[model samples]
Target: MARADGPRTANGPRTGGGPRADGPGTGDEGPVGGSGRRFAPWLPGVLIVGGVAFDLSTPPPYTAAPFLAAAPLIAAPLHPLRLTALAGALAVAAACLLAEFHGVRDWAQSATEIATVVTVALLALLINRIVRRGSKRLASARGIAEAAQRAVLPVPPARLAGLDVAARYVAAERDAAIGGDLYAVQDTPHGVRMVIGDVRGKGLGSVEVVAIVIGAFREAAEQEATLEGLTLRLERALQRERARRADIEQAEGFITAVLAEIPRGDSQLRMINRGHPAPLLLDGEGAVRQADPEVPALPLGMGDLGAWPDRVEELPFAEGVTLLLFTDGVSEARDAQGTFYDPAVRLRGRRFAGPVELLDALVADVERHTGGGTADDMALLALRRAPVAPGVDRGR
Candidate 1:
């Protein structure tokens, strides 16, 4: 997988329309966005033996010996190639010395061997140049990818006022930092509303849809007082974008979303589910409950079918309650035997000191269940409300 940073070229300094230093805006988009690079590893011994054999077999009065000396270039860049060239020269010199062991060394023979050695040495130098240049390019590419990722998805804060907020994003495609998974939490006039959604597919198409959905959610969630309205707002926005694309209807793709509004000074938490996996509520007393919607909720982008938003479910998410919202990457994560991960079963009765601990434990549990490497990208978002004062909202 090639990284989205430094791009690959056929050979030489491959040129393309790049960001001009004095151009209009910052060109954060790399040649390859998100997808990592792939490289073929070189074998050392094979090239060395082949080079020696070629030198031995070829009837060369000229310096094909130098080319053979340079054989190790196939294995590495500058450092090893330079060493190999020097080693080849020394070997040739020693071989000549041994041939005339009984007598003084011949000038003609020494000159030919030395010349062959020097030729190979120059070839080694060429290999060194290639390696040094490659490393620099790779480093530059890495820097670009890092900058772009930060711009695309900034790191979430450790805490949000009284709420313990933790969020993470994983790339489905190898080396990709930003994907279709998106989340936004803002303190609005109504309340501290939040959204977690997974757009359809991956790559540029999904990213575009994710941006659209997030933009709509952020705008509507702040303005709309109710979760139902926010759901409708996101759906309508997705619908409008889909209508613009000609081939959008031909495909069956939608956004699975979970929207929540935490009212100030209220133990009850209001949420609207749009066909997404129900969020997990981890209580202070070591209890876990799946907050599934009462009725079958349709995913966003299907408003044309006349699906109704379920009434906002207000669960008792009192102080010290942690809400875990995730994408299918976590719920649908598969084990070695091809079994879907059951968070409810695994996290049952588990005790955690804080929201961070709960998230870390859950992530580790998922990794252990799947043996470390995950096929799908998982996004984990945990929010824990602090324990209120004694008798706070108790009679209310």
Candidate 2:
């Protein structure tokens, strides 16, 4: 596949969830947690007051110094610098008051207790500053990563050509915005062509392959006359990428992908599967069918192992029907009992108004199956052919 250097343009509005654009770790906002986050600011005061009560109730041999020392430390990461300083001062004051209440019979012991509190308080202030600095740095890094993900996988338009479309990318790691899974859809001269694939690995290496695959697909989708040709183009792009990266070649990296095309004014869809999960088709009557390949082919980037001509299969794609494509993340997702999530089974009799509704239901079902967590990232694409209106011309 030839390398595409020119920038690509999106056909419609982008729709998908990604990293928080508002940013994280802001001082005004409480740290991430449950109900405890709401009460975090009060914890230091509670600790200080509890320490005084413990000191008074406990035998003189057992000092509450440890409890007092913990106050400011607890406040450091959760509260503002001023609040942390106030917590430190409160802890020190409590320590001194306790020391005086117990009497100054041992001046050395009293002085040592007070000194420890003071030292701990000072350390807490330093820690507060360091934590704030680190939070800011983390926020900056997250912003850059989000930007990179958007650039690599620009969100597909909600509508492409005459079909209603929706795409989603869900990363396994909470902090990650992108992963090995990728999807792209574009309007071409032949029809609306799209691709969804999963690179072998994860992290930056996988992201690089994602970029290459998408770049090649965008260019090939417009130029290639057949789905097989587009698949070959993507295969060559990965091959070229592997040749340049020694590590990828050594690892024998490959991408499981499916190339799809819907010719203009046609009621059929053509697809070429390359060792990837078969896509699901939902007709207007709420019937589901798996668009499995007649002849299985190896995934792209494995041409070195064996080579065969790509085969494009045609499937019925009538009006009001939706096609759903996704990576292994969805099919392989396991519940606590190790049961895999079967989309076909879950959506067999469920009818949806549009592609967006279909995908929304599918994603929600997958999250429920996996208990809101999965071992791999997921990329989903749904396309629906709009039904013809009464007395309207079929041809545009």
Candidate 3:
């Protein structure tokens, strides 16, 4: 039961995929390599031994396939060139022994052939070298993805001018990028605005939609005079994009989004629900009320078929009140017995110091519920009106 911190140990041999999922990311493979690390080392040994066994039994016609056998062995870069070189030598040795044992050629000819095989063995080390560099570059790309994701979806700073903001995004698949769910929070001259939505598909295509939607929200949230106007703008933007690129809405591609704008000096939250799951507003004391608008607008992109009539819903968000906006992943997540996750009931009245704490707790709870990974991406954005007092300086 010895559990080591994952994704923390400096460029060393990766241990097994210990116990926890959210634990530190191990290996030099960035978060992409976080899912499994426990059995990585033993793989090379098993393959090398198996290759040697095969060589002994068959010999000629069967060249020891080092790459085939030990491909996963030298997967991480930290392993020395020696391991690969050794693997290659083993293959060549098998070739030479088989040449002699099977009497395929004369002794002198066999010796010369084995020398060529040995040279090829060393050359195989170069392949390992190239793979190692490639892994490093891939890890670097993953880091850039993390930074972009943060900037695009800022973790609500501990405090905003008039709101408390906290958020988290979890990819449905392990080691995946942002995928299908997206959330954004920003404070504009008009007020504190937020958007949370789920795109139709997964992978890079869904991420592209997320980028387009957020880009539209950031631009429209500021200029538009009203929340309804903002909704119209977003719907049109989506349709315009679809019209220009007919492939955008291919098969099944649409976005379910909920946009909220808190006027500069009001406790009311003007929300325009666009076929998304209703968000919940938690009272300072931990009571939950589903903030579903009466007139539900169509999911973005299908707006041309029908006008997106926006309805503003008002909720009494007192000082320290928190509004939790989430994609369907959280509510729809099921346990072993098929019980759905109840965020309101589970986190009722719990005091999360800041956004990081809130997200950490939420992810931990979700992992516990699903036992490890959720099938669909989960995105959450929680905004709490900072205790309207004059003591703490809230981060933007």
Best-matching candidate per lDDT: 2
**TM-scores for all predictions:** 0.69, 0.85, 0.71
Model 2: clashing residue pairs? none
lDDT of 1 by residue, 1-396 (tens): 011222212122213322134321111222133321111122233333433443334322222233334344433452355565555454455434422432323455445544555565566566677777888888887687667556555566666656778887776666576777877776677777888888777666776777777778778977887788888888788888888876554133488889898876667889888888899998876788999888767788877788754678888877788999998888888888999999988988888988778888988898888887677777778888876577655221
lDDT of 3 by residue, 87-177 (tens): 6666565655555555543455455555655665565677778877888888998888888787677666656776766788888766565
For candidate 1, the lDDT comes to: 0.66
**At residue 238, what lDDT does model 3 achieve?**
75
C-alpha-based local distance difference test score of model 3 = 0.68
Clashing pairs in model 3, backbone N/Cα/C closer than 3 A: 6-24, 6-25, 7-25, 7-26, 16-37, 16-38, 17-38, 164-384
Residue 376 CA displacement from its true place in model 3, Å:
0.9
What local lDDT score does residue 339 receive in model 2, on the 0 to 100 scale? 98
- Distance (Å) between predicted and true CA of 332, model 2? 1.0
TM-score winner between 1 and 3, please give it: 3
Off by more than 4 A, model 3? 1-78, 82-127, 147-151, 250-253, 390-396
The best candidate by TM-score is 2
